[model samples]
Target: MSTCVYVQLRCRPGTTYDVAEAITLKEIHSELYSTSGDFDLLMKLYIPTGEDVGKYINDHLLDVPDIERSLTTLTFKAF
Candidate 1:
């Protein structure tokens, strides 16, 4: 089955727009947007298998510039 991960991203101070643009350029995220609360951005990611989830996050999402922190949530059920 496919795996879905929801990521809460905190961007560096004064860099939200730049970070968002960078994320958009990558085009790896299923959805990405700015938001309030403890995070500046939220990202949805899909992978073909659960095993690739870790690598995908570490190699791709973590590589984005101006990203201060990230919280990843793995989906357990659709409904």
Candidate 2:
């Protein structure tokens, strides 16, 4: 089964839009949004079945340059 995760990203000053565009170009996230908080961008993604969640995220999402930090929340159940 696919794993659903929400990732919160912190970007370098003046680079949030660049980071967002880079991430969007990757075509990996199910949805992406700009938020007000410790983090700048929030993304919801489905980790494909049989893939290692950590590795998948590291390779695909976290690779975006100018992203200063990331917090990943894994979902255990829908309700």
Candidate 3:
């Protein structure tokens, strides 16, 4: 089974758009968007079985410059 994770990202000041664009360029996140909230952006990602979510966060999400913080929620079920 596949796993879906939702990530709320807080971007560095004035870097929201840049960070969103960069994440889009990476093409790893399933869905990404800039939003108006406590968090600057939101992203959804999918990982195959046995894959480490932390590794993907560190290697792909964390690697993006100007990203300040992230909150992740793993989905248990979907309709």
lDDT tens readout by residue for model 2, 1-79: 8999999999999999999999999999999999998999999999999999999999998878999999999999858
Q: Write the per-residue lDDT of candidate 1 for residues 4-28, one digit (tens) a residue.
A: 8899999989999998898889888
From the highest TM-score down, the ranking of the candidates is 2, 3, 1
Whole-structure CA lDDT of model 1: 0.88
Task: Answer with 1 or 2, whichever has the higher TM-score.
Answer: 2
Q: Model 3, range 1-79, lDDT digits (tens) per residue?
A: 8789999999999999899889999888888877888999999999868889888788878999998899999888756
- Against the true structure, what is each candidate's TM-score? 0.88, 0.95, 0.90
Q: Could you tell which candidate, 2 or 3, scores higher by TM-score? A: 2
Return whichever of 1 and 3 wins on lDDT: 3
Return the lDDT, model 1, position 63.
Answer: 91
In model 3, which range of ten residues has the least summed lDDT?
70-79
Q: For model 1, give the RMSD to the true fold.
A: 1.5
Q: How do all the candidates rank in terms of lDDT, highest first?
A: 2, 3, 1
